[model samples]
Target: MKTSGLDVAPVNLTHGPACATCNGPTRLTGIEPHPMRPRTDLQTFQCLVCDGVQTAVVSLVH
Candidate 1:
């Protein structure tokens, strides 16, 4: 699915990233290119069970 022009994919709870605070499965809520890094992405996730939010910076492989 797409959100505000950003592509967001549905996450499988059983394999998705878990929340650090509650260990609950998180869904990808937002993503964009990192401001300071080339070929890198900044992603945001929200815990499905606890509504907790987290951000991650991932380097692109190619």
Candidate 2:
């Protein structure tokens, strides 16, 4: 798998979430809107230590 344009950038976080793989800090990579659902959003995170990617589903309410 190639992550050419995934926007994997490292961010400075004083208190960030821990990585599931390496127990390291995670940084927000990108956010993508769901195609089928208007109120749903997908948040992508990358582990700073392990470089693992994780996707989280977020629901927006009015």
Candidate 3:
């Protein structure tokens, strides 16, 4: 989510989080590789209430 300039489309990881901007419950929507490092990802979380999406780095599930 923090990373940028992705070469390909991201995959959904199905994780959930609280929206940082709106403080709403969010569902994981998309995922992509970390541009700066390996074995990590930028996971996108979608807020159900505000319909906002935010991305953050998290360990790869598998």
Candidate 4:
């Protein structure tokens, strides 16, 4: 079997019960980028209920 991208580390998914802004029952899915670029690494998440965008420094480990 071929495992190029498949071998790559997986992005962590965190669930947020409430929206940070509205405090509503919403979830935030965070994906940590590859650790090569720590500073550039960002956490991107979208609210399933409100469609809100939240970003943070999740971290990376090469």
Clashes of each: 0, 0, 1, 0
- Candidate 2 lDDT tens digits, 6-57: 5445644433467778888888877789778887888778888889877778
| Best model number under TM-score | 1
Candidate no. 4 TM-score? 0.44
Best by lDDT: 1
Encode model 1's per-residue lDDT on 1-62: one tens digit a residue.
64697455554534458898899988888889999999899888888899998898988763
Using TM-score as the yardstick, the better of models 2 and 3 is: 2
Please provide, for model 4 over 1-62, each residue's C-alpha lDDT reduced to its tens digit, 9 standing for 90 to 100: 86666445544355654567666554445556646765456666677667877776644344
Model 2 scores worst on lDDT over the 10 consecutive residues at 7-16
TM-score of each: 0.70, 0.66, 0.62, 0.44
Q: How far is candidate 1 from the true structure (C-alpha RMSD, Å)?
A: 5.3
Candidate 3 Cα misplacement greater than 4 A, ranges = 1-15
TM value for model 3? 0.62
